[model samples]
Target: MSSQSSTQGAALAPEKRETFSSRKLFILSAIGSAVGLGNIWRFPYVAYENGGGAFLIPYIVAIFCAGIPLLFLDYAIGHRYRGSAPLSYRRANRKTEIIGWWQVLICFVIAIYYAAIIAWAAMYCWYSVTKAWGNDAEGFFYGEFLNTADTVGVSFDFVPNVFFPMLIVWIFTIVIMVAGVNKGIARANAVFMPLLIVMFLILVVQSVFLPGAIDGLNAFFTPNFDALQNPAVWAAAFGHIFFSLSVAFGIMVTYSSYMKRKSDLTGSGYVVALANSSFEILAGIGVFAALGFMAYNANSSVDSVVSGGIGLAFIAFPTIVSAAPFGALIGVLFFGSLVFAGLTSLISILEVIVAAFQDKLGWGRVKATLIVSIPVAVVSLLLFSATTGIYLLDTIDAFVNQFGILACALVMVIVFGSGLGMLPKLAKHLNRHSSIKLGTGWMVLVGGIGPAVLAYMLINEFQAKITEQYSGYPAWFNGVFGWGLCGLLIVVAGLISLIPWSKNSKLEDPEYDQHQQNVQAEAVPETVSKEY
Candidate 1:
């Protein structure tokens, strides 16, 4: 075979020539990606809004029912194929590769907006150091940062002041991606994730010591059954599970594709989920406790303590920090931790697209990293320039978090739950050494109940948004148009699947199988695959 044909043949194989990442590195990278700014900033605000402490029930339920099972599904698919999103799904089932590719595309869009948000966090961290948030910090932040074009009549401008910090974020993300899985992403996570945990623990400890910290903790942990009546609560819980676990974006798949054959999928999945949930719980205790203290100090209601989007981190958090004892030092640590978490997740998202470029386009990994980084950096610079950039960011955040991710995840559940028969096989692969196996219960969750709940949430959310027209929504915010646009994008992506591979060979073509066997024989030792 010619070199080009050989490369195409390997791509068509179910198994390809690739090195397995160390299990330790795999766990660290996955955990790093999961424990992001969402766990710290978004989760607390969302939990407070939905039910304060009440949202935990559905959130935890969603984790086991959907999060854990889907994680295993992604891991199984990636490890089996040893390829990135599109190729992994193509190997598993050719027809569903379109669904997988759509997931990757969503990740790309998310990465663009996500880079902008990361830049915001980095800017906040820098401001904290510069002491730019002077007296009346909250007022200044509300006026200068949170207020939108509609609210303040200021048009967005992409100036050098904002673009420079964004450039830093992009550069940092690229450096991690260029290093590949082990030495770069995994190692950085191992170091930074632990530091984040330590900082959060410190904050939690300090928060519990506050005057009303116990009361705050009580309110957050106590169950409020009334929250169950609101469909928004269920929707928020479901969305959090999907976003927190980093599912449906091809991120988990890309990360897992680097895992060693002998890596423990069940163990890794459980650990990632547990670690992520623990961070949420800890963040809630810290945030609500501080908020409780703040409310007492300001003579405000608990509801007054709640904030969302960038305001939670920049405005609300700064207010809380300023009131705390030794507030400046604490603020620095907290925001610094947030920056670390955001950057870690940012790296993973960027890596997914970079990996796709390298695997499909045959670009060198380093070269692909730089190529993807440039556009991401430029777009993020534009996004940050919106005088209403914060508002625009919030909209994109909701669209991606609430709609895009849910849409992608729904497709994933349908594809794996129905199109692919790999769930049971995956459970067996994951549970090979474990005493506990995800049995019929998991199958029911992934295949039937999970998708049903997702569909219900989507429909109910759409209806609710339609009924509630806020003054702030743009003229273009028509519900039917938005849903149709999303649907069209997904369908267009699926149509791309029908196009034949330029190489004109099926995955099961004999030549491809032979190439895989040859590559496997030469690269991976039999003992490695057999080893635990």
Candidate 2:
């Protein structure tokens, strides 16, 4: 508020915005973003449905051929250009600026609902102490806890149980966002990432000692090689790897934009990729082990109790905790891990939007953080804190992730592959920055193989959607909420791009210019001539 402070803030240079203090911080922050609730709740069921242990084959293949390659692309662009996704894309191809906005908006939409889920984790963290969901976890989650009304539309009917904790979740996220990149986001990941792993290890160690531990591990790892022949199973494998690695969203681009010039971009990508998948395997072991105990108690097989998404985390896991020895302590640790994982991911989502504002409008970090965080917090508190919150979250999440994020990723792959002919140049840029240099194999995977898989995913989803409603939800629900929002996101992104870019914006840093010069000189195709 003082004149000197005001002058300093207004005069802040673009280079002074923020960066990860160390390579360790960068890797951990990215891993935290990728290893969200989905890796734990969704991957186990995806594996179970797609041939259990045999699913690892497709999952690993998808990672090497699709996930890690796209990750390198994101890292190369962000680190080379030192801008948010939109700015970075504009730098790649001025015409593809809208693609960057599209991805950034998708991150914004995801952040809104994602914060609400973290709030649920936060509340469950407290509820664990007394087994507050009581003996019937499912009923408590739908009835007493969420008080979820049986409706497809939004309502003003608020649920105090969900509202208060969600408020705290938003508040905590805002404080961290306001703390700036190194001091807040990176530092928070440095702490929570370790705690999350330690707590999960405790749960897994305790779980294997349970009476049905072997049964659970068998259910998870038991291979069904025949399932690999099914295209749907292979599709599931690609989808899981796509969402799990956080490539489609702008989170990786935004996070990597903060890395120092000499950092190893490709090496860091591999590190984050392995760390994320490693956590998924660890979660499978702990989650299935606990579910094994639940099935044992009910005189059922692991197959009988197996479910995914909210059911696995809120219902199945809680049921296991209540029946296990030392239920309360285990419950606290489990839900606490969810809170940490979800919180770290939520910060990354918010940073994507904040970075966009800072890069385009030349706003300072605090101003950008407050501008974006305040309204989003209000929306989360109001939009997803009602009796119908659970249903609304389900519809929106399915719609946004499938159509919004996946579609953007496909566009990016095409733009880099053939449209702009920049995939070769981007790979060259990556090799320039990384010690472990990539070759033509990286280009083929990202430009050709990756796009082919993504196109198949989009087409597969379209074919299924045309024939039947997703999840057996009402046709009207799928139409209005699912497809309608996907279309709207594109329109909104176009409108966002129409906003006047900051004239005073400076992308003329010597290092930024030098990186571009070297990339163009190395292997840029003759067909690609545009320069940002």
TM-score of 1: 0.86
Q: Model 2, 1-532: lDDT tens per residue?
A: 6999988976763455378989999999999999999988999999998999999999999899888988988887787667888888777666777888898878887888887788787788778777888879999999998888886677878889888888888888999999998999988999999999999999999988888888999999999999999998988998999999889688888888899866888889999999999999999999898888888989899999999999988998888878889877778888889999999999998899998888789788899899989998888877789887777688789878876777899988888787877776776667755767787898889888888888998988777777877777778877877888889889988988878788755544545767668756776545433342
| lDDT, candidates in the order shown | 0.71, 0.85
Candidate 2 lDDT score at position 106 = 85
Worst 10 residues of 1 by lDDT: 523-532
RMSD per model, one decimal: 4.9, 4.4
Residue 320, candidate 1: Cα error in Å is: 1.8
lDDT of 1 at 127: 70
- Candidate 1 lDDT by residue in tens digits, 292-340: 7777778776677767556677777677776777666667777878878
